[model samples]
Target: MFAEEFVVVDATSPLWNAARPFLDIALRIEQQDDSYLWHGWNKASIDAFLQKLPPHCSLMLGVWQVDAAQEQETLWLGCICEVVDGAVCSLRTFVALEDSRLPAIAQLEPGYIHAQELIRVTKGQVAPVAWALFTDKTTWDEWLLAADADGQPTDKGEALAALARQGRCVLLGSQVTHHPHHH
Candidate 1:
């Protein structure tokens, strides 16, 4: 048993969707009670799981049904997981969108630590809860610019730096640990 769990398809994973019914599961696009339902795949989660598999071993794939309320939707994100040695190894997700511009996340390349955090933050979470904020170029740039014009960090810079440290972005790079100016 691999004993792994589902990650919330971090902002970096290609599978993240911002719209309601974000997942592939069937539900109304518009809601009367201000809530809709959804079920979808999260490719990022699957990829993370596959890497952990033992070579040449059989992998059992099945759906993990999750039903819960998120934001304005009572959603069901149809999740999948691989069973290795009779234990769950990884939980991936699926999402289908009508628009061509898919949702974006910070984690284009999911590493072990990133994947683990997703599981910890999103495991057992559903729908909107599983979905993270969308960080586009402009938003990311502003977050990076919290530093002064000279590129030194301020108090806000430190907070932004903290977000970067939590894997929000990599722009901080070597500067993440740089000391912030203090009075």
Candidate 2:
């Protein structure tokens, strides 16, 4: 599971401001899914799901079901988001129990749990941008460590541009399954 913390330093923070443009777009995408239900108490459900997940597994969002009748799944719903160049900041999606081989929702599903944690952390906020699903670690590190003349990163806009220049950063939206140590 990937856990990250993003705080709105200020109401006018560039990231905060940049995030606005993408909210409508993200919400429209979220609205496409009908199978996934939107609930208020997502945190508790996520905790329960994580307790039962296997390690190294990540969640996939925007996956279409074979049956067109089924509603598209909504992954990372209700999370705060910001747009960077027309992409949503977050990329993970919540898979429906029916679509996955994983156990029932009652059982702890690590992927579900991790997704929930992400939602809680972002408080339903997502970056107003879409990132490529497969990113290079070195490049990601560089983006994270990049700073401007005042020692500040080039802001989300610059980061997105930099990421594009280097290569597509793989967007990991699911939880990484923890492997049991073999003695």
Candidate 3:
């Protein structure tokens, strides 16, 4: 549910008690095609997720894959969620990674296309799709330079500023607003 559902697991949620069983179910579902199976967790996504989550609620599900066609190391993580009135999503993929890095500046379009395609490929088990994309550092720095180097920012610059996190490491926190038809 991480990439497909955007499930954010809050320890304070009423469903906290069900975490183990929930994770068990999530792990059993095979989201990827047989050939794209991941043998283990991606270390980078794990570190990133831990840094983002609070100390008390660090538990989550993480899996990794090497996309041979793209030569990318893709990782999907789900912390689970408080959604569905405790129904729709018990697990959610929060971050989608390739080569252990966020999508680069020029790669956004294709990145988005691939992500959106997953919903269809995975059978639309999620609600409206929402994504918070973090561009690689190069993209962030380039944005800083091109959008008025160290000066007053423009609208896009302002947006980057707002989405900036962890000392402004993130550039594009854009959310895909289009809601795919849930099957």
Model 1 / residue 71 / CA error / Å: 24
Top candidate by TM-score: 3
Once fitted onto the true fold, the runs of candidate 3 whose alpha carbons sit more than 4 angstroms away are: 1-73, 76-82, 85-89, 92-110, 121-123, 132-161, 164-183
Model 2 — TM-score against the truth? 0.24
Model 1, residue 77: distance off in Å is 20
Tally clashes: model 2.
42
Q: Estimate, for each residue in 1-183, the C-alpha lDDT of model 1 and write its tens digit.
A: 234452333334333332223322212222212222121112333334335544322221111112235312112222333344443444454332112232222212223343333333332332112212223334444553444454322454345445655655333111123455343
| Candidate structures ordered by TM-score, highest first | 3, 2, 1
lDDT (Cα atoms) of all candidates against the true structure? 0.32, 0.33, 0.35
Candidate 3 lDDT, tens digit per residue, 1-183? 233464443455333333454455444433443322122223232234334432222122222333569965444222223233222343433332223233442332324454444333222333332323334434434443343343322344344455443333222112323334343
Candidate 1 vs candidate 2: the TM-score winner is 2
Q: What is the lDDT of residue 27 in candidate 2?
A: 50
lDDT of 2 by residue, 1-183 (tens): 113432322344323333343344435434444333222212233234434443323222211112236632212121132333222233322221223433332332224344344433333333212221223334434554454554321354346454654544334433333335343
Where is the poorest 10-residue window by lDDT in model 3? 54-63
Residue 105 Cα positional deviation in candidate 3, in Å, after optimal superposition: 22
Q: Where in model 2 is the C-alpha error above 4 Å?
A: 1-98, 101-133, 168-183
